[model samples]
Target: MTAIELRNVSRWYGNVVAVNDVTMTIGPGVTGLLGPNGAGKSTILHMIAGFLQPSRGELVVGSRPSWQNPAIYRRLGLVPERDSVYAFLTGEQFVLATAKLHELADPGAAALRAIAMTDMADAAGRRVATYSKGMRQRIKVAAALVHDPEIILLDEPFNGMDPRQRIHMMELLGKLGAEGRVILFSSHVLEEVERLSGTIQVMVAGRLAASGDFRAIRRLMTSRPHVFLIRSSDDRRLAAALIGRPEVAAVELGPAGLQVRTSDFGAFCAQIAVLARDSGIRLRELLPTDESLESVFGYLIAN
Candidate 1:
């Protein structure tokens, strides 16, 4: 299986650091790079793809150092977030050009195969400039796969895709991962990452905050209280009932409803409905305030 490794790596431009002493291993399967905007996901991917040089430490793809190694391109395929396709070229021509650049034995056949794989065969004759955002994304994937690289790096691959298009691409990535290819894609959307990848690497302000299965990572943060916003028919009575529960850490009465902090997420969720019913309180709304990735990252950073 192909793998990429980074050891105590750091990258900076002038005085600003983009990646800070990150050491992680990316192996065969789909791994999600999860982080907020400007969180160094792209920077890390660029360095791994040999597009940028690390200021310190080492980065390797298989047995070779990625920096200054043009041969890595033979096994590594990067689909950058930027829109860099040639507007004048048709989708087929674009993939064909990439195949030729990779020195494939038969560029025509490879391009055709890639276009078909990405479900872009129908639009292969259309000029790239005329394609929709999602179509442009598919064409980029077709170009990336033309050479059939073992390691695929995608930076926000679902940026412009609608629900249907996104689901299709997700299935495609899952299939690629199942075929024993190392596929890593960066995304800020938690739902996308949760649905696609089994493992995740989270970056926060250039630092690696968490890594591994998200559920496991969440379990590690047991001390980090889960906050909830709850509105009920009788806010005062519900708040009183919730405060008496052993699972609840604290409860505050608010203008909107009851703001609750729970030490045990699972327990709180499981007992909320029962507690409301027993207290004769009708549930109007219940929202987890700290369920977002940003909130989770903040909790991690604070620790």
Candidate 2:
């Protein structure tokens, strides 16, 4: 299988380290590179694309070192975060130009195929400058796919897309990954990353913080108590009832509702509705305070 491997790789500039000593393997299927801003995701992608060299250790694509290997470009396609399209050219023209640049045998056929794949065939004749942000993104993806590369790297591909456009792009990526291609994309949006990839590589402060299924990672974080914000018809009564439960570590009554800290997340969830029903308190709202991807990432980084 064609895979990218980083073996104890680190990149630095003088006293500042952009990517610390880390190792990971990226193979077939969609993999999400998740991190906050300046967390070395872009730095890592650049190194994989051979645009930048590692300061120390090894970076390999397939069986060869990615650095200084021009041949790797043939098997790799990169959809960069920055806007690099030619605004004056039509979408068709842009993709055709890219196919020509790749020295494909049939640039027109290749360009059309790519344009159709990205759902941009209807707008193929429109100038890129006249296109919307989502249209431009689709065209860039079309150009990236023109050569039929085995490995595709996208950096924040969903950044400016509207909901419908984002959904379409995601579906297209899902198809590509299903075909057994190596699909890797970097994003700071946790929800998007979680929905799009089965495997995730999380980066924090230039270090590999976690890897593997996010759900499994969350289960391993048993040290931190789960917090819930609950609103009921009777806050004080609900708090009184919950405080006695062993699953609930602590409960604080407030104007909004009760702030609950639970030692057993599963048990607390299982009993919350039944308890409320039996107490004759209507449950207005029950929200997990720290279940968002951002909150989960914060916990990982903190510990």
Candidate 3:
């Protein structure tokens, strides 16, 4: 199976370190490379794609070193974040050119198939310079996919795409993953990563903060308390009752509502409703304020 492995890989430019001793294995199915901008996501992608060499340690794709391996292109496709397409060429010509470069059996047929896959068939004849940002992105995707690669690496693939286009791309990626393709896409958008990928590798300050299922990683952070905001008819009563519970770590009555810090999330959830009912406090609102991917990323970065 096609897989990517980074073992203690480090990349630097003089005094600056871009990727800091990062180590992880990316296997079949979609894996989101999630982090804020300048968190070494693009740097890592470049190294994996063999555009840049790691300063130290090993980086391999499909059990072979990616650096200086032109043969690896046969099984790998890349949709870069930047606009790398020629403005003078029509979408069809661009894709056809990529197919020819890949030395496919039938370049024309491959180009047509790829263009159709990206939903760019209608705009295929139009010059890329005349295309919108979303349309341009689609055309680039078509070109990348012309060779029918086993591994797809996309960097911020959803940038400039409309809601409809985003949905289509997401569905396409999910289908590709289901077919056992190793698809790795980098993005800082938490919602995009959370919605699409079952597995995520989070990067922070050039280091791998967390990996595997995000929810599982959240659960493992026992030191960090889960925060919740609650509003009740009787705020004081609710706060008083919650403070006495073993699950709750702290409770503060604020102007907006009650802020709760609980060590045991599952237990706190189970007891909150019962505690409110017994205290004669009508539950108006209850929200898990820090249960999101944003919160997880924050915690990871903070620590």
Candidate 4:
């Protein structure tokens, strides 16, 4: 199986450190590289794609260093965040050029196949300059996929896509991952990462904050309180009951709803319904406000 590995990888620019001693193994399947802006996600993707070399430690793709290794491109496909397509060339022409560069036997057929995969076949004949931002993103994905590589690296792949385009791209990536092709994409959008990837590598201030299952990581953060927003028939009564529970650390009644902070998430979840039932309060909405990627990232960064 194709895999990317990093061992104490560090990339620095004079006084600035971009990727700071981060190490993780990205195996076959969909993996999300998640972080806020300026969190070194793009830098790591660029280094893995062989656009930049690590300043220290080791970075490898398929057991070989990607830096100064032209052969790595054979098994790797990259859809970069930046707009790198030539506006003058038609979408089909651009993809065909990429296929030719890869020295494919039938570049035209490969380009056509990739264009169809990206749902860009209808607009493939039009010049890239006439396409919308989302269309351009699709064209770029087509060019990247022209060679049918084993490992695909995408940086902010859903940047300009509309809801329909985004859903299609997500489905396409999921399908590719299911076929056992290593797929890694970077995104700051918590919902997108959570919805698409089972595994995520989180970056915070150039360091690897967390890795593996996001939900598992959240569970491991026992020190941080789990917050919830609850709306019921009797908010005041529910709050009064919740404040008396040993599992609940704090409770606040606000205009939105009752915000409950619980040290024991599982315990609180188990008791909330029972407490409501006993208090004769009808439960309306029970949302775990901090059970999201954003909250996890925030906790990691803060710590």
Candidate 5:
């Protein structure tokens, strides 16, 4: 089932457009929403979580309109980007309160379950204000999961988590996803998204850049112009010979080495290896250019 849908959604703040004609669907399983900082990713998440109304398009959760629909809250739980929560209340109290507000039959049992799921049972009696950042994040996720919401929206969920904490959270999310729930989380970290999400929605400059399996997106992103930092015995002769080859598209001499942009990344790499072996050029270093998410977003914006 389609968990969320934005139909040409546009959100504006005075004159600035935060989300521009964005339309996409988030379905079951773990879906990664990706974009650079201030790329309308947060805005999109806010709209889906019913925190912000779309200026011009419809935001729907399942078959019902989500804006101003408190009924959806029963089935949708949101873990916001902001850390602000009921800090004065203990973790157990906070989660119990959410359950009570949801009118769950047994709030105490619900809270206990949530605390255990988050591994915060040991700290359940402590006030949220006393918890560490990672602890607080765990509580927030636990609260979101307390009611067993069908659709869970998380924004930068792994932002401040250590490697171990991140792994823990990822495992929890994986468990929730395996139970056939819809988990949509947003992040800018390339590897993080690639690791957790089976499908990803790429956003760039308030626009939907791409959406598909990670391997397909990787193929698309990795297929284009690639700059290889090649080090050889005779840099000058290697540069001349490389640029002369039909596989290479462009060349630039740099302080570290020559930067060659090759259209055929696979063929260019193979040719370079063979050329180095045959010509007796002592190859020293070779590394693909760093393809950060920022650079990927730049490509989307460029087009």
Candidate 6:
């Protein structure tokens, strides 16, 4: 079943169109929103979360209109990009208060379960002002889960988390998805989203750029030249050896190192390791300088 649906939704700000004729459905699974800064992702999230009303068309949650409906919140949970929660309240107090606001029968038990779910029980009594950014995020997550909503929307949720916290959050979200919850998260980082989300929606410059399963979208993305910067002990020799290969289109020795442009990503990478072995040259560093989500968004928008 579709937990959320947007039909021909359009929103504008003083003649600047933020979302243009966008339509989508969020089902019971984890979906990643991929876009650069100012891609209208936040606007879309706000509209779906019932915070912002669409100027045209309909936004629905389970076949019911989501706009200005407090009742829909009973099944919806949102974690905004902004970290402006009740900073003065301790973790436990904040979560308990949120649960109480939902009129939960046992707010204390609900809050305790939320805290435990987020693994913040140890720091539940500590004031949020004294907590780290990662801890604060966990507290916010706990607050969102306090009501046990069926749908969750998170915007840049990996913001302040370290690698460990990021992985932990991913695991938690995966578990949520496995339990058939609607989990939608927004992120500007491609690699993280690629690993975490089953589907991806790409937005570019206030427009929906692309939408599909990540594997299909990744194929679309990798169709372009996989640009690489290679630093090797024998730059001249390696460049000469790789220049005539079918996968290698262009190679140049620049200020940093050797810049390689290849249409075949797998072949290029495999060939690099083989070249190093046969030529007895050690490759110092290999970097994909154009593999960022921002670059991908720019490429898609331009295309």
- What are the lDDT figures for the candidates, one per model? 0.90, 0.90, 0.92, 0.94, 0.84, 0.86
Judge candidate 1 at residue 138 and give its lDDT.
90
Native-to-model Cα distance after best TM-score fit, residue 19 in candidate 1, in Å: 1.0
Candidate 4 per-residue C-alpha lDDT over 171-258 given as tens digits, one digit per residue, 9 for 90 to 100: 9999999999999999877788888986999898899999999888998999989999999999999999999999999999999899
Q: What TM-score would every model get versus the actual structure?
A: 0.80, 0.82, 0.88, 0.88, 0.78, 0.77
Q: How far is 236's C-alpha from truth in model 5 (Å)?
A: 18
lDDT digits (tens) for residues 87-151 of candidate 3: 99999999999999999999999999999999999999999999999999999999989999998
Error of 2 at 115 (Å): 0.7
Give the clash count for each candidate.
Answer: 0, 0, 0, 0, 0, 0
Superposed model 1: Cα runs more than 4 Å off:
226-298, 301-303
For model 6, what is the error of residue 148's alpha carbon versus the real structure, in angstroms, after optimal superposition? 1.2
lDDT of 1 by residue, 1-303 (tens): 449999999999999999999999999999999877887999999999998999998999998899999999998898989998999999999999999999999999999999999999999999999999999999999899999999999999998998998999999999999999999999877777877875889888898889987766775798778889999999999988988999999999989888999989899999999999988889999998876555665666676
Best by TM-score: 4
For each candidate in turn, give its C-alpha RMSD to the true structure in angstroms: 3.9, 3.4, 2.7, 2.5, 4.2, 4.4
- Candidate 3 or 2, higher lDDT: 3
Worst 10 residues of 5 by lDDT: 290-299
Clashing pairs for model 6 are: none
The best candidate by lDDT is: 4
Model 1 weakest 10-residue run by lDDT: 292-301
